[model samples]
Target: MSNAADLRAKSTDQLNEQLLDLKKEQFNLRFQKASGQLENTARVRQVRREIASVKTILGERSRTA
Candidate 1:
């Protein structure tokens, strides 16, 4: 995973793309949880953090723009 600085350095478009990917992964994780096939429950927390990271970068970029 990239650091906050690396994330912040990404352009808005890149951040958006990353956010979309993260969201898709989050959805898959949720589906696995529902199906009782999720092996690592900790993945939920990690993905949540990744989502938040992308959001933070996007929000910061928007404010600056």
Candidate 2:
């Protein structure tokens, strides 16, 4: 997991790309859970939080821009 400071330091374009990748991962995790193939139950929570964090950061940047 990346720290808020690290995410804030990244450029908007980079952050957007990372956000896209994270969303893809979130989708896969959901599928894994539905199929009963998910091994790390904790990962679902982690991904959700990470997605939230990235969105929050993006919002903050946009508001300040």
Candidate 3:
């Protein structure tokens, strides 16, 4: 999980990359849950929140620019 300040400091390209990676992870987590192979159930919530945070930060940057 990344802090807001840290995320805000990164370039747009980096944030986009991170967002892509998070989406991929989210998909995998969902797959695991469906297959009953998910160990850390809490990770799904964590990833969702992180995805939201990254998106929020990206929105802020876009509005300011």
List TM-score per model, in order: 0.89, 0.95, 0.97
TM-score head-to-head 2 vs 3, winner: 3
In candidate 3 the C-alpha lDDT for residue 31 amounts to 100
A best-first ranking of the candidates according to their TM-score comes to 3, 2, 1
In candidate 2, position 61 carries an lDDT of 87
List the RMSD of every prediction in angstroms.
1.0, 0.7, 0.5
Winner by TM-score between candidate 3 and candidate 1 = 3
Name the weakest run of 10 consecutive residues (lDDT summed) in model 3: 1-10
Model 3 Cα lDDT, one tens digit per residue, 1-65: 78999998999999999999999999999999999999999999999999999999999988998
Task: Name the top TM-score candidate.
Answer: 3
Q: Candidate 2 residues 1-65, lDDT tens each?
A: 99999998999899899989989998999999999999999988998888898999999988999
> Per lDDT, what order, best first?
3, 2, 1
Give per-residue lDDT, candidate 3, residue 9: 92
